[model samples]
Target: MLILSLGRAGDMNRNMLMALVAIAPLCGCQTSNQADYMQIGYGPSFDVAHAQCEMQKGSVDQGYIAIGSPGFVAGAGIGNALGNLAAEDQYMKNCLILSGWKRAPHGQGAAAASAVAAGTPPTPYGIQRAPGSWINTALLDWSDANNKCVAGDKAACGTRAKLGARLRAAGVNPAPV
Candidate 1:
């Protein structure tokens, strides 16, 4: 039984050796060719530039920058690669600075906070609405009514007055006169 066990172990070792030999070449397989790696390294600057532009466009665009995945991935990969490259590090640093990735005293977050403190409402352009606070029907209707009144529609003004009256009747205000 010991002799049989020894023989089986030897056969298993041989099979493992053969499997390793078979997989050696495959292990060295280049998923990304030289050209592909180069393309990945330096494919297009436009997308990056566009991303930067969108970020600098304002709070709306900044919100987009905060949430956008493709741009973040591309930027991070490129930044890491360039950061490793001694020759292009300076240029990449400048690019990153220009793209607002670098720290700044009066950057977007600070500016936004200041604006909020100043009682200014942030505009949602490219920014996504939060799930729970999405689409305030009352505010939308109020805005629509205001827009119609601004367009000189007497009916909208009357409708707005009626809404005000209803709110006043509900003990909400000093009663719409």
Candidate 2:
């Protein structure tokens, strides 16, 4: 049974390697910092991390990056290290987006709308209507908090919980209705 399991594990690893290689080109072209490309501009007045914590109302969960790239001999693990960072960066961006962060307009583009601003309309249970400014601040704050949380900071988790409580009482940003 042990031998059989080892064989399966090796097969799985081979498959993963193949997939990673296949995706490498796309990853290279796209770079990992999707959020940085977004050009969001938050104001000085808003408490970005706190607000994001309130609006998101959830915990941050991110994936781990593998160390040591197979391709390198001189600095074998550098590629893998970078890959891990990219993965984490993407994770942070996605986390913030889920928490209602909007991507700002880039040059030709106009200011991007968040889920609420877009009016896609979410479930009625915890809906809120806060000012766009506040929401924007929260969006940034949430991202920072999420980054800290993913980095294994326990205090950030507590902060998020506190923010959630405050929002529950006062209402949420994006126009706390």
Model 2 lDDT tens row, 80-116: 4456546655655665454444333353112222333
lDDT accuracy of residue 111 in candidate 1:
51
Model 2 misplaced regions, further than 4 Å = 1-47, 50-74, 108-177
What are the Cα lDDT values of the candidates? Answer: 0.40, 0.42
CA deviation > 4 Å runs, candidate 1: 1-79, 82-135, 169-177
TM-score of each: 0.23, 0.26
Tell me the deviation in Å of residue 40 in model 2: 11
Which run of 10 residues does model 2 get worst, by summed lDDT? 37-46
Residue pairs clashing in model 1 are: none
Best by lDDT: 2
Q: Best candidate, TM-score-wise?
A: 2
For model 2, how many clashes? 11
Model 2 error, position 167 (Å)? 25
How many clashing pairs in candidate 1?
Answer: 0
Question: Cα miss at 107, model 1 (Å)?
Answer: 31
lDDT (Cα, 0-100) at 31 in candidate 2: 30
